[model samples]
Target chain A: MTYCVAMKLDSGMVFASDSRTNAGIDNISKFGKMRVFTRVGQRVIVTLSAGNLSITQSALNLLEQRARTNPDALGIWNAISLYDIAGLLGEAMREVKNRDGEFLRQNNIDASASFIVGGQIAGETQRLFQVYSEGNFIEASLETPYFQIGEIKYGKPIIDRILTPATDLTEATQCTLVSFDSTMRSNVSVGLPIDLLVYRNDSLSVDIQQRIEDGDPYFSQLATRWSEGLRGVFVNLPKPDWLTPKI
Target chain B: MTYCVAMKLDSGMVFASDSRTNAGIDNISKFGKMRVFTRVGQRVIVTLSAGNLSITQSALNLLEQRARTNPDALGIWNAISLYDIAGLLGEAMREVKNRDGEFLRQNNIDASASFIVGGQIAGETQRLFQVYSEGNFIEASLETPYFQIGEIKYGKPIIDRILTPATDLTEATQCTLVSFDSTMRSNVSVGLPIDLLVYRNDSLSVDIQQRIEDGDPYFSQLATRWSEGLRGVFVNLPKPDWLTPKI
Candidate 1:
């Protein structure tokens, strides 16, 4: 299980992913689930994956191999638009699924995986997409300005409350980390260090990519303060008038 | 889909359930999921249900008929402890599954269902149990003092943050509603009017059973204030020092 979230705001985009993966409770390990691709001044594409490690690793390996061996051919590096990049990712996922889906399914394993891929590509506006295991995708819209993959529900409420297309990059970063904190608390499978990247719209370069390890001062402070603040707010909320008297 | 949660605290117990039921997105209806049985001053047992509506309704019907038709049959009404009540409920559920499970399975429908049953019988202290589809059940312990059934993840973080065995009944009730609020906001399948009941320790009577209808004043106020307070806390948190300067 993993928890990854990405937001495409008017000011920029934010991407975050946890580094925990488990085959079972006793067979847990750490793996970075985010991939960053950069062509400074031209493109800055970030991808956060969730699902079978083998399948995503295979898909990512295929993309990287294509870029390395055939730079002249169309690949993530030369894709004219973010849509093309998402399509390439979807194709890679489908290729891997076609190869591995049956073997895993025979053993009653889930072969499905998903990715939140988004960034700017020189000529167009920054866009975000949630690519499915079936080689299809949907872009985020004003009505839904973010995409989340894997162990997503525990962290969803806060994102639903705070994020919008107009949210600033820094505030969105704060919200995303708080979301991760809530997820890490409720679920042990999603642990630190968190890989986070904040992209400024039109910058076409990765400026802030921070890995929040255990005991990292700022993340520790933010988690503690968010928890304290939530409690403070809850205790101060007006109790039900009827129940308050009885208590 | 549904969202139902029940908590057993040192002060008492709190139970809540959303009323939305759907065969599919287009085939939606409302049915209260919380049922209370009270023999004032002697016993007060509450049951919250989730999963196949037909199965739970049939099981509840079976329990009601047994208690009404044969008082000497050791039914819910005569159960010596809340555990006995939970067992009776489980037996009824098993009977329903035996009758309905095969047919539902033949059509590829899920026959599983679960219940959170709790209350106090005369000589016993209040206890809570989560009865599974197979009729086996587990009692809530001091460490895990609550049970949630159906669409649970979105609302779980707040409860994990605030609840403890020592939490008071009013605060638990408040916490429960906020959880429901979070679930309802994120998943439309779980909706109001919410059915909520608060039971005080050793009080063998139903004191607070609230149906938070759409536009219910207190719930509306709580939801509004909570959203505002969360945003307030979020903005006030110290931004990550490194990112703050860049933004």
Candidate 2:
């Protein structure tokens, strides 16, 4: 199980991903799920993945191998637009499926993997897309400012309440962390260290990419403050007076 | 789909269930998932169910019929302890499975159902049990004060943050509503016209059982207030100040 989310906001895009992966509880391991492809002044692409780690890793490794061996061949750095980059990533996923899908099916394992690919090319606006297991993809729009993959429900309510196309990058980043905090508390499958990246619109380069661990000071403070704030608000809300006597 | 949760607190118990049932998204209908069995001066048993409405309704109907015709047949009213009532409910589930499971399986349908039963019997302390599709059940303890069935994840974080053995009945009731509200907002499958029941220990009767509708003034106000409160708290929290502009 995993939890990864990306938001395309007015100011920029925010991406967050949990690092835990497990075939079973006893097989749990930490693997960084965020990949950054940067070409200094030309483009910056961030990809967050979830599902069968082997499949995602294989697809990613194939993409990285292409970039290293043949920079012009379906590499994130060489893609002209975010859509082209999404297509290239999808092609990579399909390549992996062709190679490993049959073996996984024979072993009764699903050849499942998904990804959120978002970034900006030198001349294009920042955009985000959610890539499916079959390599199909959907881009975020005004109506849906955010996309979440894996164990999404526990952390969704907050995003649904607060996210919009006009939301600022900083607020969206905070909201994403709060969302991750909520999920981390309720679900053991989604653990730290969290990979968080914020891209400023039109920067065409990585802005802030930080790792949040279990004892990270800022995250710890945010969690405590959020919990206290909720309790305070809860107490302040008016109790149903009609049920007072009965209760 | 349905969402029903029941909690056993030190002070008493709380049970809440949404009233939506759907064969498919377009075939949605309203059906109460909660049933109250109270032989007034004797026992007050509340059962909240979720999944496969037909199967759950059949199980409840069977329990009701048994209690009506064979008054001494170890029904909820005749059960000496809450544990006995739980056993009776589990047996009812098994009976329904025996009658319908094969036919359902043949049609490629799952005979899925779950229940949360909580109440006070004349002689024992208030108790709560979560009964599964297999007719097996587990009781809630001090460490885990609540049990939720069907579309549960969207509403789980709030309960995880707030529920405790010492939480008062009113606070617990409020927490449950907030949780349900979150679930409803995130999931179209779980909807309005929620049924909320509150029981006070040794009261020997329902303290409050209310149906909250879509336009219910109090609920609408609570929802708006909570949303505003959350936004306010979020804005006040410190933003990540990690990235400084290069000199």
Tens digit of lDDT per residue, candidate 1, span B1-247?
9999999999899999999999989999999999999989999999999999999999999999999999999998887888878888899999999988999999999898999999889899999999998888999999999999999999999999999999999889999999999999999999999999999998888889888999999999999999999999999988898898886
lDDT of 2 by residue, B1-247 (tens): 8999998898889999999999878899999999999877688999999888778899999988888899977776788898887887888889998999999999988689999998998888889999998888999988999999999999999899889999999889889989988999999989989999999999888889899988988788788888899998998887666843410
Clashes of each: 0, 0
Which pairs, if any, clash in model 2?
none
lDDT of 2 at A77: 61
Top candidate (lDDT): 1
Q: Give residue A37's error in model 2 in angstroms.
A: 0.7
Candidate 2 has a TM-score of 0.96
DockQ of each: 0.83, 0.63
Candidate 1 wrong stretches, greater than 4 Å:
none
Fnat of every candidate, listed in order: 0.81, 0.75
TM, chain A, every candidate: 0.97, 0.96
Q: Residues A1-247, candidate 1, lDDT per residue (tens digit)?
A: 8999999898999999999999988999999999999989999999999999999999999999999999998899888899999999999999999999999999998888999999999999999999987879999999999999999999999999999888888889999999999999889999998999999988999979999999999999998999999999999988898898876
